[model samples]
Target chain A: MTIKLHCFGESGNAYKVALALELAGLDWQPVFVDFFNGETRTEDWRARVNPMGEVPVLQDGDMTLTQSGAMLDHIARTTGKLDGDRSEILRWLFWDNHKFSTQIGMTRFLMNFLPEAKRPQPVIDFQLGRLKAAYGVLDAQLKGRDWLVGRDVTIADLSCCGYLYYPEPFGFDRADWPEIDRWLNNIQSLPGWKHPYDLMPRAAAA
Target chain B: MTIKLHCFGESGNAYKVALALELAGLDWQPVFVDFFNGETRTEDWRARVNPMGEVPVLQDGDMTLTQSGAMLDHIARTTGKLDGDRSEILRWLFWDNHKFSTQIGMTRFLMNFLPEAKRPQPVIDFQLGRLKAAYGVLDAQLKGRDWLVGRDVTIADLSCCGYLYYPEPFGFDRADWPEIDRWLNNIQSLPGWKHPYDLMPRAAAA
Candidate 1:
């Protein structure tokens, strides 16, 4: 049975797992969640699909999973590819969720998705400052290394790179971060690597 | 060997691990990180401690672990307490990191820790809205349950409850969320449970 991923393109959290599945060579299909239309916030969607009301919920046979970090770990653990030192990988995954992707995801949504007049400028500015600090941390860690964790690419790399591939301006400029830029290139050069927009069906209008 | 936790009381992320160590009956000592004094951002601190420049780093024997979610898993795995369904536990742990505590941690810092004049009003209002949604999700999940996962309290409980126990307000009022309040009570009822401030040395001035 092919694994089903309930996701939308705008969510970098969802893209993390999709990229992992594709790169790991797993049989997976995308079921788009109309996040722009407030589908995730609906009562039926919350009750039936996810109580957390978030995307990137994966169903593989009897097991239904949410949380992109956990899904990435599951894909890596089951496939035996893109797997590495568990503790180290988990550390980065947690950091990405706590400090990296989550911040970027919200900042991107505020900057690009929300109506220009409705956008909170002060909030966006604050987030951009925070994001700059987070980017510096990632760049510093990537200095003298190709991947976030170990010599080979792992889910840690996949998790952190989720929001970086998008074209939307979330106050991140790859040219400004050379180490991160090179590290992203390393991920892009992977055999089956695909941009997030290419890997998942986007909810945003082209 | 005694575990050394590099943490400060103000960080809910650190409290998650400190609570776990205390509840797990581990011999642990708190090594305070002077976050307010800008210790974590220093080059020497980043080079010697965590490159992520965050707290709640656990050092036991030769192993040094950062990220509270990873450290919680480590404590649960090694001590055999607060362990539950791996996927279920991880799902909440990831959710807490990505949504629950991280948002509250930042919002609380902005609202309470930062100088009142320096606090950005728009950012606080925006974060408060997002936090209400997160609180609803957590409250709905805990509606009829004693804990976030399984029949007993686990790291998921510790992780989500990290910021909830704080005295400082970040727009969260226990009375406003009955389900979450009850769930917090259940965690409080746990034997050997200690408040975050009680478990770690506080860096902020009272």
Candidate 2:
């Protein structure tokens, strides 16, 4: 009874759940979604996999969950490994979805995935500014702590680190933020951490 | 011992928590933040309220919480209402934060809040297009349903309806989406419901 995650390699949101699954040693396998080829845009895919037309849809037994934050919460609850201060963990997860990963996902897509002519410079600049602010909040939060919530590596770590590990140019240079760099290293130092590309199938070279 | 919410009238994220508190009949008051000015940008405010420099920070006794989704969970937990289908509700909350309200908030800010010359037209156009897709997803979900999750009116409703009730032109025309319009009416019919401006104080007339 392996949990199947409907995801693609380019999705940091998907990687959040994938990282958690790998860390927890859950019986799970990645189900590739050909996003760049427009597989998710199909009506049949929408009705069957996810109506939201998004990735990282976790199918566990009869239950299917969308939104990487919610899926991470389910993984934390089921495995009981990354479950720490409830409110603190939830706050960070929500923040990651609403701000951090959301911005990085789009910025990275525009910078690396989209055609060069179609890349909107103004939009990219605006997003980069906002992401710098988001990076500041995350870096400040990690000033003295290894993990986001408590001393343990909760889903908060997995959630916030969704897009940071990607090799693409998403306006994120690890050397720019010392504390976040250290924190990411701490997460990389986990037992069974896998890079996003190694965990899920990528649609393209980017 | 009434709860205090550090918020502004214009923030949809703040309005989510405000709606939950009002619907739950909680003894709470809105402590206005001068976001239209430089209040939230100040280091002192960042340290005292939220390092994220965002609004809708709920202070219940000594416990303070940021991110509207997290605060709504608190209100739901405390009032014993709007607490149905934990995973489903969380999914929608995350969706709203990640997609719906996030885009509307930015689009509305550019369309109305920001100075005319300062508004980024390319960015606004980009966000408006994305907001249309988000609206389509929401409208489709509400086609034959009265609420986002479960039969009961959960925090999902409160969260998704955050920016919809605003008068600002965020590219959302009620007549365009019939299902979403009907669902919005259903929420408006809820007892003790208040519009964003009515629920909290605005900085200036827009």
Candidate 3:
């Protein structure tokens, strides 16, 4: 069955789902929603699917799924791309969802999305500290290990790399995290690495 | 193999793992980490497992897994507790992790864990708004359905209920969410609801 992903054109969360589909070599149709016009909040759009009024909702045949992490897990499980010891793969996947995605990704968003006048200096400082701490954890985990889990790339890497690379667009330095920098470069060099980001040009900012 | 979960007693994240195991009818042992004494930050604990140094790490024999959402998904999949159309189950699970778990759970933590002097009112208000908005989405989703997904209980419900009930200890109001309240009561009455929580009384505040 062909999978169709509905999401805003310039979203890292949506890119997460798209990147996984590309890595898994799965065919998917991208249904772009215009975030500038508040398309996600529309009742017709939300009520038809994803009552949460969020994007990156994937529809496969008759089934629809949300949450980039969960969707990635389902795709990985179904396509037999979930490599490594089952428990280990799960461990990395959870780390991506909880720590990396929540702390780092959200902090990146706050740093990027908020207007200069509206963005509080303390909030930015706090999130920067969190991002650094989180990166330290990821850096430590990646020490001497080629991948986040197992030897080969997995959904965990996809989920994390999508957000980890966002700092560049926001003009943040990646110098402190040499391992993470290498990992990001590795992910960028992968086949179809640019497909999702290409669809969202605004994601790679000045 | 006996499943062992290492976590502090009052953590909602830990409760998520325990709830999934119980719902799946899997026997597991709970190991407490005394956060009060900084047990989680020890190098021995970090080196042995969980480089993230967070709890609700599940150990199945020789395999160790951390991250509560991923752990819950693993248990659900292993025990066959996740039912309904695979796509729908996947959607709800993702919502549980990304939306409910991230937004609502984080708000509760800030309100409870951060001292009043350090807790910014604006941040709290913003998070509270986000939580209420997300809860509205869930309440609407639950309007006609007894469970979050499918006919029976699934990990989606367990994940959502775990976070919703967590605020009871912090004196968060539940009366505004009647369906949520009813659902929380239903899950609390389930067998083994108290076992993991009992093992870590401080983690299960209410």
Per-candidate DockQ values are 0.81, 0.81, 0.51
Off by over 4 Å in 1: none
Model 3, span A1-206: residue lDDT tens:
67888865457778888888877889887887765567777888877876667777889887677778678878887898745566566566556665556555556556666566776566556657656677788788787876887788887788777665553343246687888877877788877676455655342233
The TM-score-based order of candidates, best leading, equals 2, 1, 3
**Cα lDDT tens digits for candidate 2, A1-206:** 99999999989999999999999989999999999999899999998998878887999999999998889888888889889988888899888878888888999999999999999999999999999989998998899888899888999999999999989898889999999999999999888888999999998965
Give interface RMSD for all predictions. 0.9, 0.9, 2.5
lDDT of 3 at B53: 77
**How big is the positional error of residue B126 in model 2, measured in Å on the Cα after superposition?**
0.8
Instruction: Itemize residue pairs with steric clashes in candidate 2.
Output: none
Best by DockQ: 2
The top-ranked prediction according to TM-score is: 2
Per-residue error (Å), model 1, residue B194:
1.1
Q: Which prediction has more favorable DockQ, 2 or 3?
A: 2
DockQ of 1: 0.81
- Per-candidate RMSD vs. true structure? 1.4, 1.1, 3.0
Residue-level lDDT tens digits of model 1 in B1-206: 88999999998999889999999999999999999999999999988888777787899999999899999989998888999988889899999999888989989998998999999888888889999989888888898899889999999999999999999989899999999999999989999999888888899987
CAPRI quality band, candidate 1: high
| Clashing residue pairs, backbone N/CA/C < 3 A, model 3 | B9-B203, B10-B203, B10-B204
True contacts kept of each: 0.76, 0.76, 0.51
